[model samples]
Target: MSTSAPPDAPPALRARHLRKQFPGVVANEDVSLTLRAGTVHAIVGENGAGKSTLMKLLYGMHRPDSGEIHLDGEPVRFTSPREAIAAGLGMVHQHFMLADNLSVLENVVLGAEPGRAGVLDLPAATRRVEELCANLGVRVHPHAETGGLSVADRQRVEIVKALYRGARILILDEPTAVLVPQEVERLFVSLDRLRTRGLSILFISHKLDEVLAVADDVTVIRRGVTVADSLQANEVSSRELAHLMIGAELVRTERPAHPADQTARRVALGLEEVSLRLSDGRQALDAVCLDVGEGEVVGIAGVEGNGQTELIECAAGLRRPDHGTLTLFGRNITGTTLRRRRADGVALVPEDRHRQALLLEAPVWENRMLGRQSAPPNSRRGWLTRRAARRDTEHLMRDYDVRARDADVAAASLSGGNQQKLVIGRELAAEPKVLLAAHPTRGVDIAAQQQIWRRIEEAAAAGAGVLLVSADLDELLSRSDRLLVMLRGRIVAQVDPRRTSTEELGVAMSGAGESAR
Candidate 1:
């Protein structure tokens, strides 16, 4: 492990011969990367290819078994994330980490509150945060509560928090995954402003098109090692990069054509004026009415925090709506348990796989066996069937392209995208009549995304109704026959995807004008 760059005018950050080994997996093996000063550098790879591992090593979440990290031409070792931050490095995680009850100003200056003589200086902290936001062209109120802000606004607060701490090098992981197309454009604009001010950015994303669009240099890693390093961003196309990632040509995604006869099929899922009151007494959903026929895909498009979670919970039987009715295949299931809903051929793919869908510490087989304990193969007469569960897990791992050494591996060891695949695979294997897919392809690689979409289409073709909730406009526009727009806990507009544009959908989502309900 040695630095390759010349000592004069050292790079902002560099890693040489980095290696990290887990129990049964080598997360990174002899990986090296360099980020020049004042540039946006991107790392791209398929899921479970050690992209997150490498970033964690750099961020000091995990120490490499063997490697040398260099900052400004000097060897360095960080014992914790705090040391990394003190060294002018900051990381914005894929999932935001702000406290919901706190205000924007408090969240920004949480660890580094300004004070004198044990007295907190609120006005000074607010002024500094406001200045940082103004510099970055982000619009956010310091007094506003974190829980009520939109996803895009919360992301801006994260970025401003990093800048407020005097970070010279920033790490952003999958920043645009939850944002609409318009919000992505705004993020790129802020990144450009930061880059011009001599800040170095390390961007980790599964989206090739976005990497190519925003990065100054691109690096590709495969199988826990660097295959391509410091390639000029303009020299490679997304197609070539995709091929390098998976060792094959990229698969194109096209929506399957719905049968004309299926248009009048039985309703698999129906919501009549569904309204919900959250535990915190918020009106999360209000008078939401929708229906998905058998063999049809109905998409819901909205900015995050706009009643999607409540709607999914209502459909999945995780929560009982305060008013209105929910029906599964013409059966009213408003008062049923979650297990009973699943027994009635209802399956759900939750938005946050780690929180709602997976047992992180459990083995893959055990995780696959969850929620089906009362059914055949998984269990019989309340007795577990280990052999049958193992067989099914192996098949799902192979079919879903979940990269892992074996079914005995812990679910937490796999990458985010792989975890998502396992959750979806388990739900789909039940052959449910109705599927609740919330951000199904949010963090997955291109190859896995295509596979997931194909499976959804196949399920719909097999007479399963799908409620597709996604922030990706293209995903909704292409896969959905009818698109519903939600704003402020209400369904404001319903548009035909074939005739709608992204701009029009964005307008409807933002509630910029009167609704055409």
Candidate 2:
């Protein structure tokens, strides 16, 4: 069903026949979308479905190969992001771009400062920023460093930055991917406020429920084509949206094992009374202890900033615990170097793939050869073998179904799902005895998510222990043999995955459930 706008209503933005193509891929093909003032428009699609490509076109990060863009009923073309911003279009990227060492006010006005002379007009900028924050109900510390803020707070700063630039149309890409349930609620509230103030919002997300809850209209894209447009949120169900995006029904598989007592076995990874303090002397991890056995997937579920990151870093030997013992295969490894841990068969797929997993500026083949360049065949006598690395990367790309043009292309050129596939492919090739996967499928499409699940299960079936940390409860419950809830820097409860409900898990993760003895 489509609702016609009022006679006086004008479209905030519209695109016609937008087309973009690379050598081997048609990134966006004759796609079109319309957005009206004060409405939340959502674009849903599988990864590589041209959602990001379409947004880049709209935001002027890339000029459309062939198309027309209209702003306020007039034909307009933008050559760059700055041009788009000047035309009242602003975008908040999935990965934030803020200076970690700078204050929030400074980061917000980094490019557009209010000053007549060389010196910055700090007072004017701060006042305007404070007013913007108040108007949007976005709470951000003006004097606080961007590095010291929480994920949610940092996102708010991004929103405020867009508003500060006089953006009438706002594009948010996967805004809720890193947020917990509570943070998501707050974000939705802010979006609603923006809508009320006659700001047009273009929301791109993989989470169907969030789209349904917040969007006024939904548009579905598949394989670079617009499959459905002007879809009313109330008229469609989540199941139908999933089918439209994935082109098939998603059959959620059950965890392989039933409840059983295998607690007596030698643990593959064990943490005993681990504690960690930050550089500023704040306690990040407090006496945390957990264990994962072979042939098992132990899930760590928590809201962000609940010490999950510190826990993962300590497990991977990237950070040392201030106190306590870390054992891998019954060997003390608390003070071991990261290289030593990796050599001891410890593999980590970090939460931030762009930062920790792959080198963005490097070629796919070079990335595939990382961490194993010292081994035989690929390298000898401190020399690199490009041919061998390329062949291996090509083979792994095919085996993992990474949809990329060539192995020589930069890793950053691939889509989010394909990048994740490359990371997983490279990490799994190590055949580690223990795998630490944090939000492995965070921004991937449904098909890629299924492939990742299969890979994780394959690892577990091969007697490799898995520690899975994610905010996605359905994914956690479906893949993990057992679930451990982390709250306030410690494990609060352990439950059989098959026996827990979403509500119960939420409560446990929030520290409202009975402690596990």
Q: Estimate candidate 2's RMSD in Å.
A: 2.9
Model 1: runs farther than 4 Å from truth?
A: 1-8, 259-263, 512-514
Task: Tell me the tens digit of each residue's lDDT in model 2 across 1-517.
Answer: 2234465876889888899998777999978888977799999998888999999999888998898999989898888999999999989999998898999998888888888987888899999999989977887879999998988899999999998898999999999988877778889999988888888999999889899999999999998988888699999998898899888998766667834778655699999999999897778888888888987899988888888999999999999999999999889999999889989999889999898989999999988877888775578788888887888899999998887788998988888988998989888988889999999999987778888888878888888889999978888888887788887787778887888987778777777864663
lDDT of the candidates, in the order given: 0.89, 0.88
Residues 1-517 of candidate 1 have per-residue lDDT tens digits of 2223344668999999899999878999878899988889999988888899988888889999999999987888888888889998989999998998999998999988889987779999999999999878899999999988989899999999998888989999999999998999999999988888878899998888889999999888888889889889999999999998988898787886665575468999999999998888889999999999998899999988889999999999999999999998888998998899998999999999989998999999998878986677878778888888888899999998887889999999999989988988999999989999999999888888888998988898898999999988988999997789988789988988988898989888888633488
Which candidate number would show the highest lDDT if scored against the true structure? 1
TM-score of each: 0.95, 0.93
Error of 2 at 280 (Å): 1.7
Q: After superposition, how far is residue 364 of candidate 2 from its true place, in Å?
A: 0.8
lDDT of 2 at 374: 77
Superposing every Cα of model 1 onto the true structure, what RMSD results? Answer: 3.3
Residue 480, candidate 2: Cα error in Å is 2.5
In candidate 2, stretches whose alpha carbon ends up further than 4 angstroms from where it belongs are: 1-8, 115-124, 380-383, 499-504, 507-517
For each candidate, how many residue pairs have backbone atoms clashing (under 3 Å)? 0, 0
